[model samples]
Target: MEFEVVVEGAAGALVAERAGAARVELVAALVDGGLTPSLGTVAAVLGALSATRVFPIVRPRGGDFVYDRYEAAAMEHDVRAFAAAGVHGVVVGALTPEGAVDRPLVRRLVAAAGGLPVTFHRAFDVAADPRAALEDLAGLGVARVLTSGQEAAAIDGAPLIADLVRRSAGRVAVMAGGGVRAEDAADLVAATGVEELHFSGMAAVPGPAVHRNPRVRMGGTAVPPEDERRVNDPVRIAAIMAAGRAGAARRARP
Candidate 1:
């Protein structure tokens, strides 16, 4: 089984790699559902890990997955930039006004990728029809899809995840993500039969104790407490991987 962690910086990437992650999806402002990280951050993460694959999610802004033409162009440019900086792959997604896969834009992004594998992001969960959306992505030659089966958590959506895996038939990889946890790893994997699992092993710890100004907030109403920061914990990550591997072993039993 392969484990992929969503990380915000080089530190988190190192922690994930040390805890046996096969890949890391680099991003920023995870509070905003992950935004395109700066190129410098991308370079730092790539330089920090020797073997762990890095797939940066290219989302210019959050709120909605529907992107305008300029945002589409920005996404394409970001993919090109990340590719140039030596990322293993890039994660991206877009949807039409009618809640379908934006095929033309994705096709252009894939072409811009120039050969690196493209993993469609969680926007597939929002598409009106998941089965047809999977086919559309496969037709576009996307290498993978990150989804929670349209549920808030992968374990809760195992049935759909399993269906996608069966439907894919190895043509596209279906990675179970979205609000995944260490405790549910074994059951999720055993039920879904997914070889790849994506999650963020976030545990809140005290941030800088010194609060310069408690009244001032960087993110306005959406700001998390400045006293603590959520990060991928190594111990939790290792445990999750072990649990997942156990599930995989059970799955392989004749």
Candidate 2:
């Protein structure tokens, strides 16, 4: 049973380390649901937190889990690059046209991970059938699967998560993620018996004001070109980690 924080940058890693997290998933542009982090970012986090295992997301972009041929190629390259750079694991996933787990393609990606642990990311939630997908992922030797219990939130999906936990039966790790806050992680663990919890621990940060082109507004009104949203914040990360640790400890005690 361990807690891993998803870190978008060096600042995030620092927070995770200080909070005593077991590991950190290094990614970039969490604004887009996390893209592959730069090599320097990976290197820096690894150097700064030598003991904490770092797993970098392998997606070249953030959007849908289904990737085209070119995107798939990029994913392979990203996995190799991360492995060469000494990352502990690569987090990735892909699906087929029918919304089923793309078993063959995903297996290839897993193989490319080159002995490093591979985690099937939340793309598992989109699988047409979660039970079948879990079996498929286990067969592919995926070290873990990051899922939201195929629901909007882990708590809401706790039943399915518990079912999957029973189904998996230690064949592979089932990590409960998505919409998980420090407050709810313990409940999720208790209800589903999941040992790994994941979340961004995000907070709002100021970005550039997005404004539409006023000079070209001959037929349009003023509108912001760019809109802002909440993103991962270091301050909140520690609190989230504390909550996870406290929760896991309580569960372990009795």
- Give the per-residue lDDT of model 1 (tens digit) for 82-142: 8999999999999998999999999999998889999999999899999999999999999
Candidate 2 ranges with C-alpha deviation above 4 Å: 206-235, 249-254
Which lDDT values do the candidates have, in the order given? 0.92, 0.81
lDDT of 2 by residue, 1-254 (tens): 57778887777787777766777888886656678899899988888885778999988776688888899888888898889988889899899978888887787788889889999888888889999999988899999998898888988999999999999999999998888887787778877888888887777655566654435533234322234335556556666666666666776886
TM-scores of all predicted structures: 0.97, 0.86
Give the runs in model 1 whose Cα sits over 4 Å from its true position.
209-211
**RMSD of candidates 1 onward, in order:** 1.1, 4.1
For model 2, what is the alpha-carbon lDDT of residue 167?
97
TM-score of 1: 0.97
Q: Count the backbone clashes (under 3 Å) in each candidate.
A: 0, 4
